[model samples]
Target chain A: MDCWIAMCVPGGASLAALAEVEHRVLGLGEALGGAPWVVTHQVRAAEGGHYAGSLQTQRGEQAVVQFAELADASGGGWGLVDGTGLVRGGGEETHMAHALASAIAHRDRTEGRVVRFPGQADLPEQLSLEELVERTVVEDVVRVGVAEDASPLLRTNGYVRLELADGRVRLPVIPWDDGEVCPFEQRDQHPCCDGH
Target chain B: MSGRHDHPHGHHHHDHGHDDHGGADYSDLTIPDTELRPADVSRRRFLQAAGVVGAGLAIGGFAGPRPATAAPGGGRGRLEGLVWLNGDHHIHTQYSSDGLYTVRTQVEEARRHGVNWLVITDHGSNAHARIGVDKVNPDIVAARSELRDMLVFQGLEWNIPAAEHGTVFVAPNSNELTVLKEFEQQFDGTVNGWGAGTPANEQHAVDAIRWLGQQMLSGRTPSALFLANHPARRGIDSPHEIRQWQEADPRVAIGMEGAPGHQAASIPTPNGPGSGRGFYTGSPSAASFPGYPLESYRTFGGFDWMTAKVGGLWDSLLAEGRPWFITANSDAHSVWADDRIRPPGQDNSAYFNANGRYGDPVSTGTPRYDRGDFWPGYYSRTWVGAADRSYMGVMDALRAGRVWVGHGDLIDGLVVTVRGSGGSNPPGTLGEKVTVGRGEDVHLQVRITPRRTPNAHGDVPRLARVDLISGPVTGPTGDRDAMSAPATGVTKSFEVRGGGEMVINHVFRAVDRSFYLRLRGTDGNVSAPGSIEPRQDPVGNSDPWQDLWFYANPVFVDVV
Candidate 1:
């Protein structure tokens, strides 16, 4: 039931440690909070700009965990998915807080979203961190991932399919030549960005 | 028309590329009945040998991407394949007050999303006009090649009443939609409004479109591609409009807009046919239109965000083996927020620039028409399937049914290939199907995969379903005299229900721009949003301009 779990500061936040990282976290502690869940993540920073982070929850299971802004840490990357193959309990785990709101979003409502491992990827150069996150967000939207309520800015919170390379992530999409008309909003009717 | 300027003897191309996703298959179904005529196809091949598209692309390389998805099973997929591109043919500009755009900016944005070629076909019916292209097309080509790699071209859209009930397309950005508009100008005096208190006519609309088709195919080839602009969406008394149009002309009215604006308008009506003093109306539905005061009008429904439902029309035309293109126009009236087109506050001044001043010296400078707001952005687009990336090349590629309609996205990347038992192609249409009345077991196969586009916010739409609208005919000539009757169309559909990867929304993700995967349904009636994204445009029955979203002259194969 935990809406969010952050190891360190969020996106682009220059943080030193994952949990102690200063960043904004949403929907944490929304689920059963009786148990404690271990967290790990990465953070990023742009010289003077505030640091940012991304949630990479894995292995541990808890209701919610706050990964506040990390003014006290260096900037670069956010949470890391506990890939230790650690035995993390199961429940309805959502990708992001809003993912938990929309049933069509995450499969783990109370448990946790099973982090996906990179099978193989040909990561490109000149790829910036924001662009990497942007790509992941795009991949998720392309796959209809991320719950409706998921923040448009949180590429990972909405099931962004990130392809981790050297030390970055981005969506893997190639333009097509001929095919059916793009479904309306795929390019035109984006609900998240429409000016209303 | 005299003061107009266009690329005198040239055309430009933009930077359109294909989507890079895993492959999609259409081999499970039968192939098209007839393919493009060898000689004509070869004639196009000859043009390709000359590398028109390539040359144009080399020149207009700056025009963003305009790549077409390779049609699978087309043997060419066997030929090392090429990249997918996109294009948007039917767009309007500030010249049409009801619109919101300009030629330069229009072409610029096309480059931004990587649309190679763009045709600015503003509403010529309206008297409102613009000071169009100068020595700028080539400059645009050079600049786009330098910037977004997009192509820019000159095109004029005629908006005369479809007495013929048709919409026509022409070249030479300055070339007015004279065929029909001229007569109106002469007959009605005023050009854009309810000219001399005249009601919109179908005959005029049809003749204009049909004639364009005739001119283009018959060798006259007036740098033009006349298509029926939102035919079924507006033409009332369906049967009457159809019959009259067909009788008048039948050049190559490809398709009407499937989704012109970002979303088709949904009209609302009273609970039931409110028996009025003189008339009756349909049942009440959703309220979409804002200021029109629908609450007061009870006899009929409001036609706000109208998306054309011309399947009945396209189906019939397809029977003859003609592959008319399907298209969409933004037909927007406003852009409230970021004119650059972001989410949550899209207020395009093209419809009515917030700072528009009716008289005096108009702001003449960079971004011409962007601030004008008169039928601007999000209103025009058409796809072509050509051997090379040139006008003639794409034209030849298109007449053969290898195209799609993208209201906002360019029409390059996503390609549509229908395979039946006939030759895989034709000159005017795609693979030929026996022309007969409805009655025979025919198999159709369609496939589409995800492709990349301008992922600004990175929100891609999920293809809920691939709708196959089989009947409908279009062209400059109104609805080509084909009377629409209360006839039910027999259909065969295929669902992309194979792997969990192919499922939509849940799992099946279409990286490709469009959603029509050549699938069929018992009674394929998706919500007003249909396969289009956003699905927020009001759906209504009133304003014919906005409501009618999509239109395609299906490759109809009669089974008698």
Candidate 2:
């Protein structure tokens, strides 16, 4: 399936740099669509700088998904993306797309930028880059400490980031005020400790 | 809270030259049971001399079109000869971009489910502003003729500025469409003339209410009113904003939803839609009021956090000495457990933008576990004690605060009366302001009747307990952003036997200061003080019939 992506290039980004960022977003979408974790996933660009599409599984479970850029987090290049949408059965597509977006946004950065993704709680049993892309997207991952402002942003997403076994942080996707608590039993067998 | 700015207070002068809707029905304001405070004959003589008694007879003049047929009914709290009309002010039809049914379908469903009055509030959009608003009037007028007993109003779900949505409705007349169409064009946030959630747009929200008031003043319609819907869904409806809306047009800006619709959402399963109760799953955004807590973000028992909290934001407004009332509605877009699905092959946006072609309601044989809402009037009911069953009667009662709200047929009848010894009349019903001598005491009489028939769900609702909440009318706070009422709370709770009607009476000795008392009843399954405790936020419950509640407007006692 197709994914929609909107890019906000940094203030001084060149035309060539902007084109490269757009090309990378398309590549990331294509990688996610080709992944085996999802039964079917597609994204397409829509009006208003939003990507509107669908993601489904072999079990007939699916979601009407939309993805958009929050802001230009990439200082002079492409930035990581944040995703939110209603999921049926599991939010694997939403989780995978968001992780891929983060990995893509942070692919070439050298400042040790720590990217935060939503649904820190909904990560799959085996959290690995291979599940999302053809091969190693990043050879060496920077385990930077969580940013101080990450708490507030995570709070806005109705989650408090968790310090996983490998010092990675993730958010609980659903906000509390929505009145529906996450009903999964993923806490006991968190994906962070499940070896990549 | 400390750094907040205070808004300038509006002039409190309200002229009382108009005739009260029920000219001679004050005697019907009876107390089934009584408790009295001792005062000399001079006390009765003094109240008569001071014009404190029977003053409600001349309260803000109601000059509106009278009902062609006035049904007769006798109830303790109703205006002498008037009756109670249960209604829903917030409703949506196919005209609303997200709604699924037509005008006729909504009216028929609501009437069958026991609602006597309903307002057709399609969402305000540029398309609506251009053509849809004018187009829906003939259907509404036709519906009114078809169901002459039911009052069908024309309204729009206004995209209120700097905050949430509100219901802007008027007493239906030939000019109703003209007024709503123009009003939306001028003040709606989605309309091209104004932007969303800005200070200027906030002021325009106030301007819009006053403009509706102007419509009433110009005799375009007998009455016009605006009510904020699902206020706490986004924490943007700040205490100051609410205070400002009321101060901007006290007569026109009435109250908000005590219980929001979508009662059947958040079904506890893997594939459920999980929109949360009332679709209120939003967290604090850039536009949110920072003062709200994490607990304020969610719905408790299908109600906004403000109203569910015994001494919460709603009480904070009432503590300011204004009659800011509360209501419940369906916000009905698609009914819960619905069987239809969006016709296959169309993209979400395409189906949404293309209104009628979305799909027809062909049952798929299996219940749509993901759909999250109830049809209007099927579960939530806003009961207005009106002088008559006409449009003006309903609007005037709402403006007067003579209303009670219920969910899942929790209680079909509720009468709350506050009586002063010196008043020659029986007592003052919900929303009336009564006066008594400084040393004289006041008594409260509360009665509730269980629904005789089962609800649309076919389950009989059992009354659990009634909570009587009272607080001093401590005027407006010094800090405009104050969001709590430490002084207001559940002073007493009366337990009921499951089989029948129940009544409770209590007397306050020498109530020397101004204060107001209101009532709330629940099924007792979910009960807490002020706000729902953090751990008790029920997230995945799908059955609305299991957790039921009813709320009554306040009855004020003014001591001189």
Candidate 3:
């Protein structure tokens, strides 16, 4: 095998040895006699910007690819291509460096709908589903007023955290505003509560 | 235009720094408690060339008396100084394809600007109810007898556009609209469904807002109060907005606007260049930043559910006691432009220039004061809470945050303390950023009264101050490409990568809205500046359309 340019050691990271030397250089010119000429495989990524993905090859040589924005490096961590020359490092190509780091962690195309909501305050950046869209909706006046401290018994930053439809954190107000009134959050706190 | 006009604002108190001290007319022009917000640039150019007497507004009340003293640190005692609740909700009189501004000059400028209330909501698509724009000013609610002063209500603002948010009200009637012809005849598309109907979604405007919230809970309509209008916006079908309700049909949406045109900027505490999250000292998008949209040209200019807590939607709806309420609106939108002020996202006009930058060719002067011109209500106002000066006590104190807001400067004796307790639940919980990351969501203190007011562009407004923004929630991470719902994308990635820091205070929320920073004069623009967006970019602000004023009443975490 008279190598014109070949180094695909794909064994993982360094991009799995450049996908096992680009599958042993197209099976080494059909096993190493030479002459089909033309297998241009290039693998890169020296540090960060990850750019974000788009490089796959299993036999379908999509290689017209050229990237080199990482200038300066050579204790063997390789890298430094201003005019374009040394790409080196297949040192073997382990299955296309895990298929290009799992396609550089691909994932793109999402408009909405997973609804995982639970913490981060169920996140809509501020929790609001609009009662799913609406049915009996009503509001005449709820006015609670208190940037904290006109009452509620003072200090500790004070206290009043409510929403828990299922698991329970309930508290609609017990020693909340000041004794005698603590409906604990209604649904069943009953007639002001004597127990029922 | 002759300086020495010290500062009383809104309906004018005029101090011009003691009108130059012979002592009688009060210092004709000395105003220096550090210029207490600016006596026309400290009498320097003295009203530029003396000449803004345009005046003429006066309507239902306050074209005259009511100053028993007290504006500097204003009505203190329990701290009632910054005031704020003043309303407008939406207006557009001739039924909004472009409202002319009437209904007696929108209740005589909400009673010659004394404003304690003035909803007249308006805009449902306009049928023109005798055009009083719904009504509400009885001489600013009969000068609240002994000068408790100014008020007005009637209201409307339903503007539904097929619903994702947008609701506003004062209601007793009307949703106004027709021409549906078919599309199941309309409901969520609003014909007056105060309950906001449901179930229609292939998107014909959310199925006409679910057939107009089921024809307003089946009664067909009336007895209104509704809210959710700017509950963090999102429409044109559904960018997936918020203001919630639909657990089968909860109705009236309840309140949330947090602070609609809310000038934006606060939550800064910790040494602040605007607190945290947003690294890349070298470049991911940093042209510059000392603390503000001045982060060179980008980093955070507006979108404040008081600082992104809509990711928790008022901390899971106030933990559990669900009574939920909050307000502040200017939602204004009628423009011709030579300079009406408009700029952020720029729908009603001004402030959209897709990078090339606009007016001043895009950024002509120092550090940024970019006043090429757009306008839009000028800067700030909203404090409505009248019982005698009524619009149903300013929509029952805007459903009930009691309300408060001030920008450019003005507030007198507005108290709001957290955790010390008073008439209701004080025992545990009040979140936003996981309620201050579990320290118990409460820590706000404000006290105002500084003078130097004139924003809608009479110039004068360099510092203004007052912010209490907060944050913390990230856990969800399943990744799905995020557009909101990774718990609202962890509220703008927690301070935006710096990981945490949210405290925009000067007292805010539930009636304690305070102010008084007032810096006045000098177009050097650094405390909150911008200029760039010559405009255009269909779906490429990168993915930003949330900031209809941050998300109402932030404060939610883990919630159980």
Candidate 4:
């Protein structure tokens, strides 16, 4: 059995600090002895002159982790939401499963593919994250470890789609480029002069 | 003073119709007294009123007279009557969170660098709206009174909702502070939590422009102007948004920056910051307009891609017969390689949140080469042709698009005139429109005075080439996001040689429809095809000093 856990940490941090937060979450998963995979890291512009982000993760049911205690350790402003009922395997229920598989493959640096339903051959080899969601059916599930090392695992750019109130939002999962910092999250790109 | 002084060198060739416009005579020069406020009259106007019109006309604060060199066969007295005031509208002070200079320091530096007028546009934020706007006004007022020769305006760098930053300024007056403070509190994106990319937030931007127009209509401020700053840097100022801003209030939201600041950011290694020129190295974000291409994120020859691309966004706006103009300025936050740092023992964040500004910066006695940006007027200059050297005069010129922009002191003077061959109507200069019968012959005359003195880099920049770009007036587009004017291109290129003033002429034999013509020149250090050729500036490591360029406003030839 699998369970989904959604956690949102309040307060704004630099890009590097945000990355460290993600690392700490992954480390917590390893300590719990559960194969945990991050689905998406949704960073958004928040009030009070900074940014706030939410991270959603999937873990094995056997891991009975104290989520409330983890929230306390990070900071006071943390919200935990249960995603178990919303996510399931197969059919339209496989949306979260595909999202989870995509992140797992991207994290492990393995090949991943979306198992398309029947009568969907005309779709191109690669699609934008938005186009993929609009074109694919509910039965399609993303599978990992499906191709050789030369080719990209997922048919689309590395974006994890999260279902929000305003439909599906895609966030880019910037891959580790041999320790080269992501330009968007450069350490030196601090808010200077009116918080640009 | 009314008599014309002959040049020492006998290279004058006044062959082409100098008699029509009175032949370089200073006696007939009339100074318009309608808008001249007592305080607005300065040394420049005194020189003009004294009938000092010749090659020895002292420009700004430079000592002595620049050699009066005329282009052979060029029209005489092209720059008579109007005073060309060089200025920078978008500059930051200590009020900005990331800025360091005081209002006095920036003003003195600008005056020393030959900037006749400037605007202190600190960023608009929650802290700024709360206290910074009111606090910075006294400094600006003091600078204005102390340096009566320099025109200092109080403005704010508006965080336009769902778009890029812009310089929102009004003519200096008693009500200037109140209007700006109210505008920022009511409309700034950061102050109102409207920084997201949504339709509602976009509407907020349009509404803000309209509100400024309302202020002008209600006579709160004598004049106001909003020029988008670094519009293409973030790729968030979509075509529709720009179009909407102009449509909302063409008087207020007149144009955008043709080139952005932070030019020293890409000056290679240990000597500079080694980042992208203009600090334009970021990729597209989720909030960015999807229509913008990858190359639009970088600067070409230290200019924004929107203006650098010949027939791109700027031309697209021009084709619609919109009064959209472009300017260049130093969005100076912290001067590059300047020996200044924030005072010690001040927690910047805590202090800013509490006091609405950082403590005054102190001299470190060591230049910080790792920083970015040049002082105002050190690199970029927006030359506005005003009737007099007044606050309203400069604002009116900017609003009328009677302006030209340059980098690295590429040219000292530029005069563009478009005339109908029939000679039935008066000739139109930059930002003016000439109405002529359909199918009438039209010609463009460009007179460029090359830089006689060395630039800040101590190198006299030579104008190697001048390009005459034109496009037809195609009316409005159904697609609001349209960003291309396919018919616009470099119609003519003139190879400039020698150090003397150069004049290039091009004629449109029997023009059929309405069109507009503009001019741009380069130093020949960097070369590529026109915008139609789809050439883009390379990514990063562009030394702004090595590749200098200047862009002049357009002159429309309307076929009646």
Tens digits of per-residue lDDT, candidate 3, A1-196, equal: 1112222221222122333333433443333333233222222232211111122122222121111111111111111111123223221134234223322221111110111111312222111122211211111111121112222321111211232222222222222112122212112110100100
- List model 1 lDDT by residue over A1-196, tens digit each: 2222332222321122211321133223222232122212221112111222223333123322222222124232223223232222112122122222221112222222212323313334234334444553322222121123323232121222232222233242211111111111111111111110
True contacts kept of each: 0.00, 0.00, 0.00, 0.07
TM-score of each candidate structure, all chains considered together: 0.42, 0.68, 0.24, 0.73
DockQ of each: 0.01, 0.04, 0.02, 0.09
TM-score of chain A, all candidates: 0.20, 0.19, 0.15, 0.37
How would you class the docking of model 4?
Answer: incorrect
Model 4 DockQ vs. reference: 0.09
Expressed as tens digits, the lDDT of each residue in B59-138 for candidate 2 is: 22434312111111111343466588999988877666666667888899888888899999988876678767877888
Q: Tell how far residue B223 is off in model 3, in angstroms.
A: 30
Model 2: per-residue lDDT, tens digit, A1-196? 3221222322211123323444444443444452111111112111111111121122221111212221223321111222233222213334334333433333222111121223333544333322212221223221111122222111222322221112232222322222322311111111110100
Candidate 4 residue B103 Cα shift, in angstroms, is 0.5
Among these predictions, the greatest TM-score belongs to 4
Interface RMSD of 1: 21.2
The regions of model 1 sitting more than 4 angstroms off are A1-196, B1-84, B125-149, B162-167, B171-221, B232-239, B242-249, B262-325, B332-336, B339-381, B406-443, B451-457, B467-553, B556-560
Off by over 4 Å in 4: A1-196, B1-79, B528-540
Tally clashes: model 4.
Answer: 3
Q: Mind giving the per-residue lDDT tens digits that candidate 3 earns over B387-470? A: 223334344344333444433323322333333112222211111111122222333433333334444434333322233333
Cα distance off (Å), candidate 3, residue A33: 98
